[model samples]
Target: MKNKALYTLLIILVQSLHTTALNAQRSTPTEQINPYRIVERCTLHGISLLNNLDTYLSGYNYTGAGYYFNHENLRNAHTGNYNWKYLTTFSATLGYTKQQSNSQFTLLASRYWSGYHPFRVSNRLQLWTGAQIQLAGGALYVPANGNNMVSVKMRTALAATGIAIYRLPVRQHTIDLRYRIDIPLAGIMFSPEFGQSYYEIFGLGNTHGVIKFAHPLNSPSWQHTLSADIPIGNNTLRIAYTANLYQSKVNSLRTHIYNHSFAIGFAKTIYKIKRKDSMKAYSPLL
Candidate 1:
């Protein structure tokens, strides 16, 4: 594992060095156009319609808390045993971002979801799509349920992604594609007091595995999701689906269940924010 980490770092270092050398060779000592002017041709800040379906990728850095209600655990409170049903598990998320345009840094902490639900209102950032390399980290809190025994499950995950988005892209705007991974943060525990008892009901007889979660367990818990947004003028229609492809559950005492979501939502584009001064300075002259 250590060697693998070293190898990955080495590869990245080499790639960066190679890119720098290439950029040096391509450098033109002439004046560079203002980014804002180049993109300002479109009326919107950086959003337009997706005339062609190009690649889309988005990543946000998160530092918000959310609650997840495990229906199975709730059901066991009355049934007194484990089950295989996961319906509605809710979690709130808060994220920060240092965004990029093309291959350059542009925005820093431009926008984010609110503490409560931010979906009720129409946010322009939610409507368009673009391709980018994203890196995110966040936590999920599962409330403590007594009796049957369920701990406050905290988890974090990471993923490298590529997206093929279908939007009406007219300007230099950002968009969301699909969440390809919710990699298992670790082999979590579900109230050890009641966990062993719960495992017995699952026919495991006895459970023997790692008792703790390795903070950001660098394990293979890859997953995938699909979501789309169809634009109709300023308003849009959206539908999304997500599910787990791999199960890296480490429930030694209790049973763990994951659910698939098929959600239908609406999106609309509003006034785009003004272009930053730096961006405008880089725009090309007509």
Candidate 2:
């Protein structure tokens, strides 16, 4: 009996020692699953030198000092008849950004201030407040049909506008799209080009209904937008010749406008950011 008890205690001691050794070995390895730590390791701070900073913001952010080549016209009652012309004006958006992302779309709230159009027209001096919505996110483009590269974007605002930017894969890098939206109007400013608002041009007669539903008035801009771009890239620099042409209707009258900017820009990957969801890799083991 004494011998048997000694053997049992010895076995217990050996087992405890083995477990302690195994635990110490595992402890030395510092196996961890910390997402914050991984994020810290990947954070890259600085401007992306290779990227064309000017084009980086794309349409979302207006240039600090913007120069627009624009065209506008009024047909009879601004719609029943169609008159379209353009202008070339120079101005700057108070708020500016030039950001480009590979996966997610960029959202920007900016003020468009310029009174220049390229097309020779009756009115040469024009000024107003406007906002721009652009697709600043990068995505995969699939060849859909003749002279077009197609990409899908889902927008939920005012009237959930669906935007499909079609790139006319011509040797020129023109990006075009036919799009539409139904959002209500918000934050409008038609102060004046130099202290005289549109109210002065048309008096104030049926301006009530007309004010809320026409160009210079009906900024309730919800229409399918079509844009185009041309390429001006070479070995040293990347240049994109870009143009945007859109036609949308309000209150049964079709309104159309065209804008094109010659942009020279490029971009390179900044740094890869590991998401928080990767922590789940260790979940099942728990």
Candidate 3:
């Protein structure tokens, strides 16, 4: 009886050791799912309309290109869901009209704080409202006018911005449709008189009230952009159209510039490492 009991105890010990060794070999690995920290998009614009107006009133139609860069940081706070966006754009147009040749170069920078709200229209719909601070400075060179050959422009304003976004899911593909608009409320702009020359302002030190306060009533300007994103493999393709309308009357000189651009670009997502049980990748739907 003692020998039989020893054999059974040995069998049970060997079985326990085998089970433990298998478990150790098959242990799960530690994984982490992190969020995208940065996103970069490059766009090439085809400008179709480049129109300008002065006392002589002329219009030009041609093709021009520009670049746009944007950075967004998102965070959830106790107050609400908010994000910060910084954008910069540089564009130049060169063309000629019946009256004269019109060329313009524009540089703009804007920073905005946008808060997202759930839209009742649908579960996939969202609306964002925010305030933006922008600084825009540019120059327009009209070759016809010997007196005012170059028009120097500087504008800074606090503007209101809004965005509407909707997502559509088709099988395994998702598409994002979004429209954004900005209107300047109030700010300061620099303009010269009807016949004032640069030599008079800087060379002769005759600058008085060159800086004028601007509002929608006086300087009505609007900027609108409509864009769509479609996923292609791991990256996204963006198609967009942008329209800019600017008009202001200061120092007895009337100015208006209208620009329309069609843009195509690619979107990329940036990711970071997180510590968790299983490794995964995460990205925003928009």
Candidate 4:
């Protein structure tokens, strides 16, 4: 009789504890929900027409087709009481010249900090002036010439850029017009001496004073971009015309590249979402 009574007591105790646990769980919440905010990024890709002039070989000029890609991140901040904006751009180009039957590739990256100021001229016209620093590097190749088959170009410059923007409100849509120009003021470039053998520079590594500090007289470059952005739903179609003029004179050899291209691309804004309160716990029950 005593054993039976103890067994019965243990069973009742376990049942009571399990019911209490169930009640506690029901009273508490199951899961928590957190809100997230998004940050946007933009990218552009297009095609280009390349024009290259090499003075090394009897003033050879060639025209060809190429491609262009650009990436940008824009942020708005406050500097003291003034509004400030920052834009960083990375662009690349690749082309093939028909006459020389050669290929060239160039890459550029720049950052700008501007003060946002908008004034009215008929409609609202936005003007932005900013200081930019850009680094550029590229290579040009030519065949059938054993002495100098390749020309290596490398440069870094501090530049100033101006941007003019106007947006037109179409019927249930919008068109944006933008024009931007970048002019490099001063920088440095690496160029071999006229008739200098690459074997002496690369193989023997006689690289003293090969890098010259470039001013307006030695190196001058300008880049222009005019683009129109047409919005359709959540995507934007971009049509742009770009022109670049780059010239350098070092060691008595004059080299310049004139490149112009028309590009059609798509621009899309992407976002990254971050949870507001990741650590907070929420109730599953309504």
| Top TM-score model | 4
How far out, in Å, is residue 204 in model 4?
1.2
TM-score of 2: 0.22
lDDT of 2 by residue, 1-286 (tens): 9999999999999989877866665455334543223210111111111111111112222212223222212111122443322111121111122233322221212112212112222232222222233221111122222222212111112222232334344453443322222232343221112222234435543233332212324333332223232334531122333333322233333322222334333322122224433233222332
Candidate 4 at 278: error in angstroms?
Answer: 7.1
Predict model 2's lDDT versus the native: 0.28
Model 3 lDDT tens row, 150-234? 7776888888877777888978898988788888899999887666788898889888878899998778998897888889988
Question: Which ranges in model 3 have alpha carbons more than 4 Å from their true place?
Answer: 1-44, 56-121, 272-286
Kindly give the number of clashing pairs for every candidate: 18, 38, 1, 3
Cα lDDT, all candidates: 0.31, 0.28, 0.63, 0.69
Candidate numbers sorted by lDDT from highest down: 4, 3, 1, 2
Ranking by TM-score: 4, 3, 1, 2
Off by over 4 Å in 1: 1-146, 149-151, 166-211, 214-220, 244-248, 270-286
* Residues forming the 10-long window of minimal summed lDDT in candidate 3: 277-286
lDDT of 3: 0.63
Query: Alpha-carbon error at 174 in model 3, in Å?
Result: 1.8
Which candidate number has the best lDDT?
4
**TM-scores for the candidates:** 0.32, 0.22, 0.68, 0.74
